[model samples]
Every structure is written in C-alpha cells, then in structure tokens.
Target: MDRSLDQLRRRLLIHCTPSQAHTAAEIATAHDTGLVVTGASADTIAHRLREKGFDGPILCDADRYSGPRRVDGGRGIRPAWCRRQQELGLVPLTDSGYLEPDNWNALRSILRVAALQRRPVIAMLPLAARWFAESHAVDDLARELDSYGVAVAVAIEHASDPFSVQYVVRHFLRLLRTAQVPVLLLRSDVAALGALCHGAFAAATGTTSSLRHIYPLTSKGIPRAAFPAVFIRHLLSYHRLDTCETVFARTPETSHFWLCDCVVCGGTTPDRLHDSDDQYSVALRHSLHAQLLLHDEIFRHTDTPDQRASAWHEACSHALFVHRQVAEHVPDWRTPAHLKSWHTVTDDPLRGRAGIPAQPTQRSVLFERPAEKWSAHERRGV
Candidate 1:
C-alpha cells in the first residue's frame, strides 16, 4: 500500500502458479517488475521463493475458485495462513472470486478488512459477470470500489472466441477507466495490449495456453496440446507453425512472420520456437518479451487522451495490416472475424457514443484495436 500507483506505469507483472515460482521470479528480474503468485498453492510458492533466496516484493494471491459462498459476504475472512505470510513479508491479495453485481456486498466486506490492514487490495472482476457487461452497472461498481482504493484485475472467463474476448476486454477497459483505478488485465494476451493502450497500469498472461487463456473457475481442466507457435503481439494472435519446415513452407519469406529479435529468441526463426525441449519455457519468454515491448511502446505516449488516441490508431492499423497479411499468405489461418472490430473502433473510436464528439471521442479511442505487424527485430533495434 505504501507504493504509489504511478509506479505501475509502463510496468508488466507476471502472474504464476506455485510450481512456476522460479520461472516467475526470473521473468520479474528480466522485466524489472514484481511477481504475483496465485492459486491454491501460493503460500507454498512464497515459502519456496524465500528458500531460493529471492529478495523481492512478492504478491501472494489467495485463490477464490473454490466456492463463492465460502468467502463471499464477510464469512470469508483473510485466512490465518495468508496473514502469517503477510507478516513474513509477502504482500497479500484477495482470491479473485467471480464477482457479479449482486456480490458487491461481499466484495465490500473483503475490501473493508484490507483497508483496515492497510493492504493493497486486488479486485478481480470477471468480464462475463453481468454487472461488468453493462455500462451503468460498471459505473456504479466503480464508484463503490473507488472508496476502497483497490487495484482492479480483470479476468475473462474461458472465452475461446477471439471476438468475444476482445469485445469484453475493450468494454471492460472503457467502463473501468472511468474510475481512474489502476487496472491489470488477467490472461488474454491481445486484450492486455488493448488494456495498456487504454491506460491500464499493467497486464498479465501465462506462459502456457492454460495460463494465457482464462477459463471459468468451475470448469474442469482440459488437456494441453503442444503447439509450437510465435505470439504475434501486433496481430494479437499466435502463428502455429511448429517446425522450421512448417514455418518456411507455410509463411512467405517476404513476410516478416518468422522474425523476432527478443533476447530469448534473438536471430531465431519462428520454427525454432519448437526446437526447445521445453516449448513452454520458450513460449513464456516470448510472451513476456512481447508484452514488455508493447507496454514500452504505449507508455512512450503520455497520459493525455490525444496521444493515447494516436497510439491506439497506430496499433490498430498495424494489427489490421498484419491480419491482412496472414489471411492472404496463410489462407487456412483461423483469423477471428471479430478482429475487424479493432478497425471499426479505429474508424469511429466513438461508434456508440452520441455527443458533440469533442471530449467523448478522446476517451473512446482507447478501446479500439486487434493486432499489429511490427517485427520484434525492428522493435528491439536489432
């Protein structure tokens, strides 16, 4: 709580499970941001980090996926275990419960305790929640939560459809930004880019598909498939070309699809992404690099609306161009049709608004965009 919210500006924090604590720490060190350890095993992760000689700020998140009634409504107090961890020097964050409009009272109860303890509260608002989908409901929710002074973490629950995910992210950003709260987008890599463009403090996605994509807390775990692909931040999608042969044959050489100059993948082609025995590690590193790069690019523009609008425009155009390239080059690529929503926003920025088009337009511009084509090599100055 002592840290100023402004410190989150242009920063990227990696969210991980207990098992991924070491990798998360490395990513934090590489990106120069704090780490957020979540899941039922977070306490174990905190202990492991301490044992491993990690000396940095660690946010211990209580997993709220068990049952809403257990911890909702003042019945769910901060566990003694979490309190002990906090005393041991880990910052405590609430488990991200699937909060709906009706659950405001429960959230209020949780925030009250955190405020009393002077803890920096992390509120996870699921986009699928009815309250979050409506502007008026969101406005009311923001007004209520603003009193507690907590940071917002958005979770998009298991949205496989690209357009639905992007729409939810954009709408949530627009509504939440009104509260002027420091927002962190959870999962959804493409939406995270859009969040930053709209002035979110930070955004997070996991190293694996399970980590990168958000699913319902109640859903059963699905088996993961090994797909070696490069995450194209500009396009807000992944290119699933596992082997060098696949990449070379599937994508045009003239297209910059195979290029990346991140320290993890420097001078490497997209096909090399599958060369690693640990494809998970490779994907995580690349995802982190893409996020940090996008954050830096958007951060370069000041907090002014006009500058943000320009940045949004530039990002959307690049994403559209890249999407076009992919569709033309790889006819079979499953590009989400909703990807065009970014262009629509770019064209009107104020598509749904009815006004003189002066102040509102500035605010609306932030929610637009789908992807970009900027090569990591070009962006990294390689």
Candidate 2:
C-alpha cells in the first residue's frame, strides 16, 4: 500500500462493479483517484487497474452481512477476500448488508480479522440497510470506534423496503453524539437524496445513483450529460452542514464506458443491451464517466472556500441539463409502466400539486419521540 495505517481519514468510496473497474481505473488514473471495489471478484479488476496505472486507493469490499462467522465461516468468500486484498495492496471497506439476529457478532468477527491484518477500516455500517436496528454488539463497538476516533459512515440504502427508517435515524443520532466521526448517509435516489438534504438529517451526506445503471437521463440540461449538478448543490447546501459527495453516472466522453464505443451502447444511438447481462456494461460505463467528472470536481471545488461558494451553482445547472436529456427508464429495478417523467402541476385544489413546483421549502424537524432507551443502553454497557 502507498499509504500507511497512521491515521483514519474521511474516504470517498466509488463502488466499482467488476465490469466497470477498468474504466473506473482509467478515470481514477487520469484524476489520480482510487476505487472502492466490492466483493472478492472486485480485486481481479483492481489488479488490472494497477497494470494500467491507477494512482488512487483501492478498498476491497467486506460485505459480511451475516456477521463474522456462518455455520461454515471458513468457507465464506469474505475472509479469503480480505487476505487477497492485502496481497494486492488494497484497503478494506466494511458494511453489514446482511440482516441477521446477531449482526454484532458478524461485525466483531470481521473487525477481529481486520485488526489482525492491521487493515485500517475507513468507515462502517453497524445497522441494516434502510433501518437502524442494530445487532447485539453494535452499540458497544460504536463506543470502541468512538474512543479510537475512526471515521464512520452509515449506509441508508433503501428505506422504501418493507422496513423502517426510524431505527436507522435513531442509531445515527447516537453516532452523532458519541462519536466525533464524519457520518455519510448514502441515498442515491433523487427524491430520497432530496429528502435527506432537506431536513435536519443533513449533518453529513453522501449519495449514489442508478443513472448509469439501467436508466440514464439525457444530458440536455445537466452537466457531463447526467444528473443536474444542482442535485449535488442542493445536497451540499440543504444542510448548514458542509462536505458533500456524490456518485454520478455519465461521462463527458461518448455515452459508452470501458472505452468501448459500441454503437448501440453509450451514444445517442446505442445498441440494445440485454437485461439478462448482470454486468450492465453500458450503465457501468456511463456511471464511471459521470463519477470521474464529479470526483475531480469535488476534490478541486469542495476543498476550496471560494470555489465551493462560487462554482456550486454553475455545477448544478450543468447536472440539471444532463438529467433532462437522459432516459427515465429503470428496467427490472422499477415496476413496469412506471411514470418518472417531469410533470408540470397547476394550482388545482382537489388533488395535490404532484409536480415539481418552485424549489421545495425546508421540511419541519421532528424529535425522537421514542422513549429514551439510551440510558438503559448506557447502563448495560457500563
């Protein structure tokens, strides 16, 4: 590894599927950026990047959802993946994506393995996606992480699941109080991203997108031919809290990713990509390109005071133009015949104004009406 385990730094992880790793690496190499490749398979792609000269960090994903040990833990892919990542000089990005009765046990096991390798963890999700209910050992570990001052990031994957967001929100509050860590709430859905940026929940933020996945809005009005950079501006500005990051989909170059200019793929007259192909090659390419644009923009702009205040508006305007031109189709992931077109609503009293009116006003802040169980939690921890 080029860097050391000296201190914990706030990291921005760009999820690179195995297929897009090469293009992602190309972009990263150009900008001197890194990749957060998920899964054991991700390493194969990361290695290729090194051969091609990528000069950023590579975080091998530790998606140990079922917690540390399964009935056949040794046979699991994660443990071996960790060792392989170390071999390739890659870092570890851990998350508890699995839902289990004893999530803490899995995390502890993962942590134990990580500590042995001296693999510095950038951040972690101690709760389930779209929910905050923690596993058995999560609270205690949160304290441990706090004492060590590790930078923590919580993933709010999908609250739209048949689940609750209350637990996730509550758990995040505890993290805010107990840890002096940067909290990254990942909500890529445009609407959800807007909501997170709207309310008091905007303390710290990060976002992802499917724009490059199945559906991509045209770049007619957006920047880099993708999501309105204003989306990012809104996310960064929504909260008095600063420091915003996003994973955008779309490259400034032709529509295709992987440097592959398949006529039906990335360009205006791209070929028809098959849905059965899990790799989502075109989506992958567009996503990498978009992210490359944003990543460099973020590093150059957000770090500077003047540029952040000045360049933000221009950036948003660019994103909006791109988003307007891209298609609103999300195949398989969304229900068929779904309507995502931009709507213009008039002042009709019978039904609600279901269109994008003038900019939305701020939402009201609601307190945690749930009884104070932290005292009980604290007492038990004590």
Candidate 3:
C-alpha cells in the first residue's frame, strides 16, 4: 500500500480491462507491477486486487477519449466523479476530451479543471498520431503542459499505420526531451519500451489489443478481436497464435528462438499456446511478462542515457534479425512495421550519443518522495 513516487517510477504499468482483472490480480501476487483500472471499476477492482495481494500503486484512468473525432458529451465524465475516484484511495484523473490541432481551448479547460482537484491528477491528452507527432504545435502543447505543472499522459489514438508508429516514438522522445514535466506514454504496447529507453518516467500498456490501442467507436459497438496474439519476446511484437503454430509445425527447427521460459509458460513451445481452453489468458499473461522483461532490460542500463539507448538498440537489431530467420521459413509472415520503425529511430547518431550531459543521470527524470512525508498516505494506497 506504499504508493510513493519512487514506487511508481520505472514500472511497466499494466492496464487491465474488466475481463483481465482476475488474471492480472493473480500475476500481482508475485511480480512488482502497477495496476491501472478504469474509472467505472476502480474501487471494486482495487479492493479485489488488494485482497489478492496486489500491493503496488493503483491508478484510475478516466476513459473519456475513445477516438480523435469523438468529443465528450459532457455527461460521461464529471468533476464530482473524478473527486469520488480520488476519495476511493486511487489516483484520480482529469476528464480530458480528445484534442485536435485547433482544440487548444479544450486543453485549457481540462488543465483548469485538473488544477481544482488539489491532488496529483493525471491529465489525459489523446490525439491522432499524425497530429501528435508531425504537427508544428508540439512545442506549444509541451509549453502549456509544463505551464500547468501537472502529470500528463498522452496517447496516440489509432496509430495502426507504420508511418504514425515511427513518428509517434520520435515525438514522444522529443516531448520527453523538451517538456519540463513528466510525459508518460499511455496505452502503448511495445512502444512503451522505446519511450522508457529514450527517457520517459512512466509508460503503460493494456492486456488485450482493444485495451492496447484506441480506435473509433461506433453507434453499434466497439469492435473486439476474437483471440489474443502471442507475444514473441525476442522479436518485440505480438504474432497470431495460429500463425505461430503453423510456423512451428512447418519449421520445427526454429522453435528454439520463439519458445518462452517465463513462469506462465514454464518452457512451453509456441505451437502449444492454443492447446487449452484458457489460451487467451495464457497469451495475455505471456505478453505481460514479456513486456516486463523488456522493461527490465532497458532499466538495467539506466546509469547513462547512452547505455540505455544502446541496450534497446541492441534488442531491436536482434529482433530484426530474428524476423529475417522467421521469414525464410514462414515465407508468408512479415515483420511488423513498428519493429522496423523502432530500430530505425534509434539508429540515429544524435539520438542517445551526443550533446547530452553525463552527470545529470536518468534518475533525475523520476519523481521521488521522502519516505517520511508519504508515510501518512501509505495506508490510503495513493
């Protein structure tokens, strides 16, 4: 229940949907992972997780931004609801609507409302990938965010395309460099690892694809995929379990590279991932554990920015090579664009090599609290 700033920093926050609550709770018993729940299920889910031995930081996200074109109808998110979330021993959030290029006024209103909370509130800034990464007003947005002096987490909604994924990582690194405040990446899957290596304080990803990326919602309903994909840790991306099964079935010799030795898998082969009724849950757990492993690798070299960037760069380079080996066997399978994009972004010589001080330390980016000052609220779980 000691949710201090030090406890929150350098953690791979797992965003759990209602369905993923129990599985996440089970994992919480062993791993030092943070839990992020939606506003509707914050209190009940937090209590459930606590009963199951999840003693890490719990954050409530105000799920107001569904897509770039969608706007809050003014009824879904209320200030009183946010205050109630804070009162429930969970970190509250600002009800920020999706911001476009011309929606600076809306951002101002969101910040103003967050300022009224009188506590540490996470301000959500959701925007289209291109607008967030390629727009000229990125510095303006950063200035406004710094001026407000609040913890802001940004999500690049609907960044399924390759170009957007490439720039989103670049833009996140740029914002983290220029912004005076903490710039946390939210709802990112593998991109979260890149953000942390480039000097982000915190990053989050969802258990399922629907929770991982933000897409447009329709009047009919939100589109949900039928099955969870397998997370190939060496490749740093998710692949279809069926596809993995085929690959292992066709080319059994390559099984050595794709097999997972995590506690959930216990050295199980990739083809056996779909062998049980709880296949979806298995895949979800494997993905979470794989991501946490990647996060640990990046944080292991946090002593210097060069070492951190070099560590991630080496991972990406090896992933790309593995993709080539996989393609030679499974001719139909191709490497995901984001993997290539991440490698390319880090390949820049100026990224983590030059013009940066050696003594400041990446530890400075984290928000640390004195143990004595936060002792009173430790029992409250905030």
TM-score leader? 3
Better of 2 and 3 by lDDT: 3
Best by lDDT: 3
Candidate 2 per-residue C-alpha lDDT over 170-269 given as tens digits, one digit per residue, 9 for 90 to 100: 4544554455544443322222222222221221111233221111123332223232221222222111101111112333231321121211122221
Distance from true position, residue 85, model 3, in Å?
A: 3.0
Q: lDDT value for candidate 1?
A: 0.57
Error of 3 at 377 (Å): 35
Residues 69-166, model 3: lDDT tens digits: 45653322357756766666666666576765556677777776776775666677776665555645677778888888877777776735322366
What is the alpha-carbon lDDT of model 3 when measured against the actual structure? 0.66
Pick by lDDT: 1 or 3, better one: 3
Tens digit of lDDT per residue, candidate 1, span 1-382?
3464444554566767777788667656655566667776777787778888776566665646323232333344464644766666665555545554467666677666655654555655544444555567777867776788777666655535333434454567666468756667665556566556566676665555655554444554543556656676546666664534453565564335445545555545545666556666676667666666555555554456445555665556666665666556665655554456555544434343222122221112221222333345323422
Taking all chains together, the TM-score of candidate 1 against the true structure is 0.76
Q: Is candidate 1 or candidate 3 better by TM-score?
A: 3
TM-score of each: 0.76, 0.47, 0.83
Better of 1 and 2 by lDDT: 1
What C-alpha lDDT do the candidate models reach, one value each?
0.57, 0.36, 0.66
**Which of candidates 2 and 3 is the stronger one according to TM-score?**
3
